[model samples]
Target: MELLRSLTIGQYVPRASPVHRLDPRTKVLATTALLVVVFLARDFAGLGLFALFLGACLLLAQIPLGFVLRGLRPIWFLLVLTLLLQVFFGGTSEGTVLWRLGPFAATREGLVQGLFVTARLVLLVVATSLLTFTTSPVELADGMERLLAPFRRVGVPAHELAMMMTIALRFIPTLVEETEKIMKAQMARGADLDTGGLVRRARALVPILVPLFVSAFRRADELALAMEARCYRGGEGRTRMKQLRYRRSDALAAAVVLAASFAVLLPGRFRW
Candidate 1:
């Protein structure tokens, strides 16, 4: 339950701030651009610049820093494992060896590489989290549909895809809660989930997974029925009560992200 609650990626927080007020399309485009630049970044300077940028966004959104950081908790194990793996297994043999842990030699280059890769991943998650934090799932769907509409000429189901993505994000918390309940129920029935070898642990998951799948399918069917009852059709004739438009601020937001990406990424290419 604690692990599931730590997932903040799909959660939304309402705020009356510039970041939240911007057109969702602008936010979507800017986030995509930021992610691209983050992946293209070569060194710490670029990541630092992005970290600062995201921090500023967090402040503008008036979201608690603790809430954003909480998302990192669930992934702590993965991060530590990645750090350990890179420390002992990554980097070339010609690099400087820092020390040895058992039979594994930790290299200076590997440590540096591990830290860099980890920071990159942190930035990526924070960026996406910021987007979902400021923009509601409905707005995200509309923005995605609009952005993907151009591809409709080539037979893309923009509305359908956007709707699916939005529904998935909105249901994350619900599914997580259901999973927790199922686990607890099984635990009460004397199911040994924690104390087990690797294979035993894998086998234990079967009970949890079976019920979860059934619950998920049941929910999906109910949702489908509900939508059908409402005569749901998001096609050519569909109209929205709230229309999305691009304003000067939207243009400025995109320009700012592009400018920052160049400012950081271009200079980032020439590194130590």
Candidate 2:
């Protein structure tokens, strides 16, 4: 649980901007469309446009740039690794040679491929960050439940899945704070967590994990009891305290996303 807390990405800063006011479903669909656009993009120009689109969305969402980049920090190493691998191990076909080293030749095709792939991944992550930052977990889960209502009849427990997701998202920040507190408490007691070798450090985590697990189970037990005491059940005719409704803003946002999708797909001098 402690390990999981530091990795959570569900913390949203609430705002009253147009993006924040838009329905969660609209933001979700727009992000999904942008993801598809990133993957379908074939050249640098298309990738640039996709990045611009994401930037505009982020600006509209009013999420802090520092916060978004901070969230991306944990995966920066992986992104670098992937880019390096692509640059060297990519390109199964011949193209203009850019560099010739001992046993490897870097070609234009490989360079373009690697750069485009990295840009695509960056755009995807940024777009998703925008979605999560703009939409609160409860709103997201509620929107998702309503969006997935049609699947409820095909043996799909849509409401249950959404409720589970809501709980998990809602608890991420709380758990992260708890983990930090526990680590600090242990450190104050002279626990040497930072100066140990790999194996030794792994063994040292036992104390942290045990308490984390105990606290997590205790919280879950209390939550279950509270739910039962309130006569809570599954989504069987359950009414929401704040029901989600799609307004003109949602339609406008959807229209903008569809237009952007078409713009990305349209053919012209930039066509690849």
Model 1 bad stretches (over 4 Å)? 101-103, 270-272
lDDT of 1 by residue, 187-251 (tens): 99999988879999999999899999999999999999999899996766899899998889888
Give the candidate number with the greatest lDDT.
1
Per-prediction TM-score to the true structure, in the order listed: 0.90, 0.90
Per-residue alpha-carbon lDDT of model 2 for 166-216, expressed as tens digits?
A: 999977777778778888888888887877799989987877788889999
Error of 2 at 232 (Å): 1.2
lDDT of 2 at 195: 72
Weakest ten-residue segment in model 2 by summed lDDT = 1-10
TM-score of 2: 0.90
Instruction: Please give the RMSD to the true structure for each candidate, in Å.
Output: 2.1, 2.8
Clash count per candidate: 0, 0
